[model samples]
Target: MDTEFELFDDDKSDVNAPPSYHAVSMSSISADSVQCEPSFVFSKAQTKQIRTTVLSLIRGMVITPDFILSSVGPTLDACATSLPAAEFTDILQESNIEGHTPLYWAIVNKRPEVLSAFHKFITAYKNDSFHDVRLACMVTNDHTLFTKLSLTSARLHKMERTLNLSLGCADEIQVYEGDTENQFTAKMQITMFQTRIRVVQKLRMEFIAQGRIWGLLFHVGDDTRWEASIYLSKHSLPARPKALLTVEAQNEQHQVLKKEFKLKEGCFLAASEYTNFSIRTCTSTSASLGSWPIFNDTIYMDSNGTLHAKLDVALQ
Candidate 1:
């Protein structure tokens, strides 16, 4: 049987504790008096000790994995630079009290901090080749029915919410909520056809002359290559029915790379069929569309600062 580590409620829990490279200083107030919580330091030796303790606790089912993960989230972040990925990965793979993997727990519970730590671990240890691990995390043999139900529920809920937000609003210009310059913005994820599509809506971008616009990142087939789409509101500008739609990317030094598409038939820009507008910076290094960096955040402001455009992202 694995030994279970005790949780200390008060200061001096670990009296005479030796110092180490990384330590968490905590304070606790007792009923009788105020007391400083004992500092628990984690060094190389301490890490090994912690690994043994955690594995034992997990196997013994004395403490829940989620609770343990949540408790040590900060520790993981602090040690990310120093700890090897394989070591941390082994630690996280231990099943939780509920028999769920750490990745699944992080995703289902929406534990952003833990999830971030996991991402860092994967990036460092797996070198961005975690697709197989991701697939494994999504599957479990013990609870097929429950997992299927959860997935169905999530999918339906997302579709229902999208439908609610997008109904009767297609092609209509809506003001971006957060700021003044964003007169148009919409984010959507469409997954009906097994295709992952991310849409970015930008309105009145500084470079563009005050018009409702859109951009898309499409991931289809098996390759990492993704195609982009640009669209302009059809009914938007009454006076100027058509205009040149130019999308440009900039380097760190602000050098512009430009691509242009023509707008016609009351539509300033259509899908890639009409023209190809390349936004070079919108590509990602990952094969999975969900891992693509384009969806991270796209907010741009021109030199003069008079006009601005914010990207609204959707993943399908």
Candidate 2:
């Protein structure tokens, strides 16, 4: 039988207290209190203790009411406050041996407060720029969790809402939400292909692969053209300096069309420079196409306006 997870005692309803780390001076902080004082000191032992404590809580807690949900955010925040910035980030980003991280569980469980708390912690920790966990897509270990995830992960992956376009809008930008698979691939499905046949001068969708940020850009004109480019020093760099990019889209009447481009550091576009960007930047491949999309949809998009396409890269 499943039991409700308790975060604190009845007397401290508003306080989020995880197990003690046996520090020099430990105090129970209110769940509603702001982050701890900067002058507060944390020992390495305390950091390690809280890390184990939080992971245990994440595994044991089951969703039931908003009270439990509400308590978790502050509990995580308090645990975070006990660690130094780098250790805090490493825990937030590290996965267990099972190939899942605390954030992954929070996301799969559909805990907005947990995600929201993480967003705050990350932003505060890395104030210079925003940081997000680099996940290709959500994955779960068991059938029950997988079934639960299927219902909640849609907003982050598939396209479901209505999209409208005006005919021949110049350099008009529309971002097709991408779905990910193939370990390091992102699929861009353009819904409303009928509209693309008319408008769709340019379209783009972005996803992360192999810890690097990437985007698929499409230009439909006298001919259709697509480019797969990786973001530069902007985020994390690709493990390899070069890669072979494969693009698959649909030709007229849903025929599969495939193309490949060799990308290296020399292929970088110098125009993408931005201040404070980290290292050597983006590489790209663009080619004119006779048609649109190549996902299973060149095999899945209906006779309606949807066209599906995919691009994958080989780490060479």
Q: Candidate 2: where is the Cα deviation over 4 Å?
A: 1-113, 116-183, 193-200, 220-233, 238-254, 264-282, 290-301
lDDT of 2 by residue, 31-63 (tens): 322244442454557545555665444433322
RMSD of 2: 13.6
The 10-residue segment with the lowest total lDDT in model 2: 168-177
User: Which has the greatest lDDT?
Assistant: 2
My TM-score estimates for the predictions, one after another, are: 0.25, 0.40
TM-score, candidate 1, is 0.25
Query: Best TM-score goes to which candidate?
Result: 2
* 30: Cα error in model 1, Å: 24
